[model samples]
Target: MTLSFKSLGLSEACVAHLDHLDFKTPTPIQAQAIPHLLSGRDVVGRAQTGTGKTAAFALPMLEQIDVGDRSLQALVLTPTRELALQVYQAIQLFNTDRRLQILTVYGGQSVERQVSRLRKGVQMVVGTPGRVLDLLGRGDLKLDKLNWLVLDEADEMLNMGFIKDVETILNQAPAERQTAFFSATMDPVIRELSAKFLRSPVTVTIDQPKAAPNRINQVAYLIPKGWTKARALQPILELEDPESALIFVRTRRAAAELTRQLQAAGHSVDEYHGDLSQSQRERLLLRFRQRQVRWVVATDIAARGLHVEDLTHVINYDLPDSLESYVHRIGRTGRAGKEGIAISLVHPLDKRKLRDIERHIRQKLEWGTIPTRAEIEARYIDKLKSRVQEALTGERMASFLPIVSQLSEEFEPRMIAAAALQMAYDQTRPSWMRVEPEATDDDRRPSRPSGGGSRTPQTKSRRPKINRVSEPSSPSRS
Candidate 1:
């Protein structure tokens, strides 16, 4: 049966907002969970990432929020600051017309700031477990009036050792209020928690997807021991020229450093990690969604609930420690039946992790050749030619006709066009790329040294075909 957000018991305003965002039908998680949640029943929804679970719980939670009262009426507990901010943003989007007072509290920001907002009378709160528990302990966060409670990514909270803190917050909430638990995995511990805390909750589960290689182009780039991964990424980015990308790194420090390097190289990029305050993170996220920022360097913990449409690539500057995380990181792209690319930067030490990931996904990942200077130049020229063709066919070219006509009176038309093309190429190309002297054949390709021996010029391997994929990146140690 066809089910829309409206048919699933969402408010008209919420339905209108969803419609504006081009949502036509409710995802399975939403279809099953929203109705029960709207009817004031507790819900335990089991769904993997990218299943529209946020809307499933958020719509009903907003519907019940007593916005006029100005007292905190709803509390959402996420496992990380990123998820908390994401949930808070989702609710704000739903309540855009209402301008409901909702505040997001988590660690790292000044507690006094959160307290100040709390005192100002917020109708809803979304926060991480530890920070929320700390606020609850201060007596400033009163759940005596909280009417709706939600635990987003409950299983992740357990994995992060936040279950105790989550339990504490849940215990303090009014028992008479409606509750919901949304988790990717309903493990024994999570099930146990729900059984103990929830009151006859409705359970809904969405099946895990099959192996991921079917939609995402998974490739691994082995950075040679002599060269840093950061240096190698330049050619890769130039060759790929991704429209949007998330470059994942292991630590907050790495995220910042990598972002700095990328920005210095004139790339459209920024860093996102736990170290940034909430307001800063919100501004960056807004810019990223609006396509003003083409790329973001983020840590896994800081990018939990980050979602973007038609992401072109996901680059792992550093491979993840766990197989599940590797899958989850790449899964951010290639969504909704669209194809995406996944790039992993690895050293010899990372073979085991790579092997485990391949085994888990039930497919072999292709080896990406770190693009040579020649390949990058070729791609640039190809793109420029394509752009020129587009311009020739477009009305925008009408604006440039006067310059071309004036130049034609002094020079051959072909020479005038060549000069104009050269200007365009030189203006767009980076000075470093153009000024470097031509390199030896071996130097052209960024690869491991060839066993300290000279080889015949005819013995070169064919370059891999260009197939671009997309998602968030993880950074390398270097």
Candidate 2:
């Protein structure tokens, strides 16, 4: 049976607001945690990042706030600026009546402006530890009357080395305030932190859906020796041809460079990182969600809080620094009970890292060979065939029948059809396939494959065929 917010003890106004936002049924975490939180009890919630945990804590806290008093009654501390902004925006949506003055305080913006807003009065503030502590130290933010404190993504805070700062902030808040701690994993340190801070907290653990592995087909492509990862990725993208994907990179420079390379290769791609302004990030996200951009290369920090439905793929252009990061990156896909694909490109040097990830997830990744030139060509031909079949039955076929008949009078019908297919293939095929450099001896290795321990095969190198058609003279339609 489905549960509603009203049955979960939310006020009529809060329930009505949820309806306005189209939030009819409560998620598992929200359904379980709301009761404890509404009764003014400290709570510890264990769940994954995209499991609707934000609303579970935010809704009850908003309901408990005394909007008439307004002096920073609630404080939510997040690990990254992106998450802080996301939480602030979510709360703003819930505050449909605008009864509370909420503010988001984080770095990368004018301190004077934040201070000006804080002085005017804010009932709630969502911010990062560094900037929040800075404001507290400068007497710009006060929490003497604070009634609720939420430690979001607690494990991420520890991973980012913010535990000390978190503790400092926790010590300054009212000792009797209601505290809620949420983390994806309950490691020893997180447990110790909760014990030291939360007062008789009620623990709530929502197991990750059992269908995660079944929903996402996880695989890895082994990069041949001496070949740059970028080169290996070209064939993989051509073969898989994801509808919409998130390509995870290691740094801002890598994100920018890879996006530039992919764009130059005629793919609809973009770069997303902290270097982009908030407005720029928002625009890129809008484009991605609207399917205007097919792929986005982004650093982990900047990609947090990004939720896109029916995402076709998650490509790890660079392996994450930690196992938790890997989980978070892949979790962006395989959501909404939809099946998706998660692919990783593994270099020879990163064998141990791949093994560590496998052990962490406790699932062996299917080892996939890089698509040969012949295989890519076959896939392209298959795609062309499918398009031709669709166009034959489509309404627009009548418009093109006259042109085909005109050409048929001068050339054989089979020759004309072949020429049309060639033209269409040339326009739609990737540019790299036409001019890929021949593989040298250095690109081959005699050693066993990484992680899977399979012997590498030896084969003679061959050059790719150059099609007769040149690059398209005009922007090709999708």
Candidate 3:
């Protein structure tokens, strides 16, 4: 059955909000969990990223919120700054009609700004574990009035060593408050968290029978450490002819460097990393979504919850540290049953991690051929042709007709197109580009796991409760 929010018992206002956002049907997670969650029951939602889990919880939580109240009603704790921003955006979309105020507090920023926003009275707070606990410790924020508490990406929190902090924050909250726990995997630690904290919570798991999405064809390249990974990337990208591709690197520095190289090599490209401002990140994403950019080189921390529907390829510029990270990285593509590809540039050092991932997922990935120079050139020519066709069909071509006619008087029409293509390609390549040998361990990898390593499950002595405190709101909306 095609599911609608109205049938799921959402208010007309919230339903209208969903409709405006073009959310016509329920994702699997929403179909099963919304009703139970709306009933104010605690829920352990086991769903991967890209399964629309954010809306599954956000919609119901918004419905439960009192618009006239101006207290910390809902507190969403995420593992990374990227996720906190994503959840905040989701909340913003839902509350657009109601104009509810939502604030995000995370580290790597000024605490005073968060405090100032808190003083203005926000109904929802989306933040990372470190910052949330900091606020709680300083008494700058209160969870006493929190109505709904969400521990998003719960397993990731545990892996990031934020489990104790999560417990601490939850302990400060009232025992009677509604709670929701969402994680991509049902690891032992996550299962224990649900058992300890949830009050007979409704469980929702929307993992498809397939571990990886069927629409994505996964393959790996066996490149040695001393080989040119940038040169390696060029042919793969050329062969794919992706409208917009996301290249995943392990660190901010690598992402920046690769982005610069790709751009210098005559590709329409940009880079995203933790070092970029939130506004800059949003602008880059907007451009990618609008198809105004060709490629985005990014790190896992910067690219979390990056949903670009038309993304055709996801390249593991560097191997992810864990199976979960690999899953999420590739999951960026092959979305919504669209055909996509995930290519990993694997070195000898990555063999163990790759094997572990394949073992964990219970499937051996297919080996694929890397494109040769001749093949790359042929594919580039084909891409140039496609771009020329697109350019000629648009209304803007009228302005170029005179130049085309002048060139055609001496050369063939195709010759003119070729010249234009070469000019376009030359103008867009990166500036600081150097075709050096592939990265060494000291150059590409972090000193530690970079929050990408897995850990054994550990138990805590007690479960902490999230408190709910509701304060009356002033009649006027700020």
Candidate 4:
């Protein structure tokens, strides 16, 4: 038997709103964590990002808010501004009754505007740690009436070096408030933080089955000793021909460089990272959702909170440093019981990291070889054949028959058909296949190169010195 939100003892109003949003059955995290949260118990929920953990905590928190008082009754802290906005929007959808005033605070936006809204008395606040702490320090944000405190994506906060800021905010909040800590992984630091903060919290962990979810076909291609990942990625993309993909890279520079290279190769790709402005991010997201872009190259920080429906594949162009990050990256796909693909490009040096990921996910990644040129051509021909078969059965075939007949009078009927098919195939072929450039020594450069230009003896181009600036201990809301 399947369990529904109504069966979980949620208020009829909440159930009705959920039904209106077409959310009928409860996900495992929601089913397990919602009850304890509604009962005013601190909860430690361990689940992947796309497992509906946001609603698990948000829905119940919404139910307990004292809308009449209009004091900030609930506070939700997130690691990134993207997630902060996402959570705020999700809560608004659940706020069908319009009983609670909700506000989202983050960096990169006008602080004065947020301060103005806070003065107007919002019942709930969702924000990144830095912005939340800043408002707290200014005495503009009060938690005296706060009844609930939620630390969403706690592990990610630690990764972003915001744990100290999170601790400060937690210490400042009312000690009696209900606290919830949600994370994708339970490393020692997270466990210690939960122990220090949550008061005898009921722990709810939703572990993925030992076997990899059947819906996701996990595969990895070992990069050959002489080839760069960028060189290897082209053949994989051609073979898979993903309708939409999220390509995960390790750094902002990598994301930009990869996006540039893919674009230069005439692929519909774009970059998403902290360097983009809020409006640029929103525009790119819209394009991606609308399928204008085939793939997006992004770092982990920028990719958080991004959800796309029917995402065909997740390409780990650069394997993440941790198993948790790998799980989270692939979790973007294979959502809502839909089958998806996760492809990773692994170098020989990173085999140990790949093994660690396999151990963590409880399944070994299937080894995949880069598709040969002949194989890619065969796939393309197979697609062309399917299209030709469809055209033969369609009404449009009759319209073109007269023209074919005229050509058949001068040439063999089979020859005319072959010519037409060749034309159609050429039109649909990928740009890379149409123009194969000869390989050069420069192509073997593992890292991004400086601009191309002839240099004099006195004017040789040199790699720019990268000054590593130490990030402040305070968290970044952006």
Candidate 5:
């Protein structure tokens, strides 16, 4: 028999709200943990990301909040601002009662604003460990009356070096309050955290089977002996023309540098990393999701818990250190059973890492040839054809009909149409491609199979600098 949230001890109002939102059944973790949590028992819930664990803890946590008391009765701690925002937003969606108040606090945003909100009597608080500790130390925020505490992503806190800050906040919260711990893995440190804090917690682990990586088409473009990855990327971006993409880099400096280079080439792209302010990060993420920005150059910080709908591509500008991380990065795309593309710009030095990834996945990645100038021009023409068709069907095309008719008298009608198309294509072409340049040797040469490597060592002096429009500014690390 199937179990529902109603059978798991949720009230009618909560069940109706969930049903209205199209949540018909409980996930495995939710089914096991919600009952234990509702009875005031602490929970050590283990589940993978995207397994509905947010709602599993969120529903029960909200159920126990005293809306009438409204003195910051509950606290939710996350490792990053993105996740803090995610949980804050989830609580807002789960709660139907309008009387309850919630606030999210994090770095990069003004601390004064958060202090003001706390002064207004928020019932629930979601925040990052560092900012939460800051506010608590300053006496602007307090957990004296707190009834519940939750540590979401416990393993991530350990990985990010935020465990000490998390412990400080946990030490200050009321000892009598209910506590819960959620993590993807119960590593030794995570287990120790639960052992030290949670009171005889029930363990809930959902078995997540490994997923086959068949849905995503994996391809790698190996940088040639003389060319820089930056120079080689322009033609690839022009050729692929991803609808939306995340280009993963290894460091924040690389992310900013690459973002500047891509922007100079007339691409709608931005940088996302630990460096940017919270408001700036939020704006860029919103723009990327809204399709105003076509791509984002980011570090590994976005590998988990950051979601965008209908993502078309995931590009590895810099390969990750771990094989599992590489798997996780590419898994962001090709979701919902739709075919997605994962492209990697591989240097000759990275062949070993590439091999490791292939061995781990048990499949070979296709070698990608550097797109030639002609191929890109052909793609532009194909895209322009669709635009021409749309323009011909719309009423706006009538204004240019008289000009076409007059030109038809002096020249052949087909020639006149061809001239107009030439003008359109020329005006829309990228500035770098407009000087009638010859295609690179990459187009004529065949790409070697994935294992082939050049024996000659390429020196740094031979490497090309990234073409930048301006100097990059250093943003603070998250």
Candidate 6:
């Protein structure tokens, strides 16, 4: 049965607001938890980062809020500044019509700004643990009158060593206030916090969908270590023809350097890193989202908390620091049921890390062959031919037909086609060029360096590929 927000006992204004926002259906976490929350039960939610958990808690909290009272009615504690900003944005969007003032307080910004916002009187404050505690100590922010408290991404807080601060914040809230906790993974510390803080909370867990988020097709490329990884990536980018792709790198310098090289190679690309000012970072992301830039080269820290929904591709220029980081990187694509693509550039040193990731996820990584030079040229030729065909079929050929007829008078159709092909090849070939063969078969499998000069095989070699396979046939087949 299709369930609606109206059926969940939301007021007509809230339902109308949802319609304006184009939120027609509730996600699983939202569906199961909203009813209990609206009825004023303490709730504990378990879900991953992109599972729509924010709306699940935010909606009920907003519905329960006393708009007439100017005091802080609801307080949401987040682990990081990025997440706090995201949650604050959601509140603003969801409460556009309800006049529910929402403010976010976090580190990485001036305290005077936060104090100013607090003084202006917001009903809800989404803040990081450290900043919230500092505000409390200064007596600039009050939680004595808060009726509801939410701990979001509790697992992240634990990872960041903020559990002590979280406890302090909780102790300040009214003892009778309704409390909720949400996390992607529950550790002993989170469990202990729940026991000590929540009052027999209603626990809700949303099973991860059977497939990876829709439209995201993930494939790993097993290229030889000594060869140019860029050569391997070029064909995949051409084949997929993504509108905008994020290329993930390991370090800030690599992000900048890669962005420059890709731009020089005729791609519209930009670099993102922690070193950029907040406004510059925002503008770079905004440009990518708007398709002004075709590619974004970013490091893990810079890419964290990017909420762009239209991203069509995620390329791991280098493997991530950890399996969890890899998952988070790829999760940026294939969001909201849109088809997305994730490609990784694996090196010899990444074998153990790759195995660890597969073990953690309980799935084998799909291996793909490197694209050959001849194959790349052929694909490029085919694409050029398609564009010529489109140009011949489309409306703007009036001036070209005469020139075509003149050319036809001197050259045969095949010769004319050859001329077109030559122009296309000259135009599309990388300005600085090399024709290197794909690495030898023995070099395809990963290897470890031994104490001696000799290389040690980590895993038993598999049957060699007779042909280089460039792409996965299907999602599950991979």
Query: Can you give the TM-score per candidate against the true fold?
Result: 0.82, 0.84, 0.78, 0.86, 0.85, 0.82
Q: Candidate 4's error at 103, in angstroms?
A: 1.8
Model 4, 289-407: lDDT tens digits are: 99999899988889998878899999998888777788888988888889999999888898889889888888877777666555567789999999889988999888888898888
Error of 5 at 170 (Å): 1.9
Please give me the total number of clashing residue pairs in predicted model 4: 0
* Candidate 1, 93-199: lDDT as tens digits: 76654658888898878999999999989888989888888888897899998898899998778877899888888888888998899987778999998999999
- lDDT per prediction? 0.80, 0.83, 0.76, 0.83, 0.81, 0.76
Q: Write the per-residue lDDT of candidate 3 for residues 336-393, one digit (tens) a residue.
A: 7688888887776787887787776666666554554344455556766777789768
Query: What lDDT does candidate 1 reach at residue 300?
Result: 83
Better of 5 and 6 by TM-score: 5
Predicted candidate 2 versus true structure: per-residue lDDT over 299-343, tens digit per residue: 887887776778999999888877878888888888767888999
| Residues 1-478 of candidate 6: C-alpha lDDT, one tens digit per residue | 8999988888898999998889989888889989999998899998766878899888888787888887898999987666788888888888844567788887768899989888888899999899999999999999878999999988778877899999999988899989999987788999999999999899999876432454566667755655556656665565556787888877777776667666655778898877777668768867877888888888766565676767888998788766667777777787777778887777677768777776665555556555434444666678888888998888997877787788998899788878877987778854432334345656444442322222122444432222222221111100
Minimum summed lDDT over a 10-residue window in model 2 is located at 469-478
Against the true structure, whose TM-score is highest? 4
Worst 10 residues of 1 by lDDT: 450-459
TM-score of 4: 0.86
Q: Give the higher-lDDT candidate: 2 or 3.
A: 2
| Position 137, candidate 1: lDDT | 85
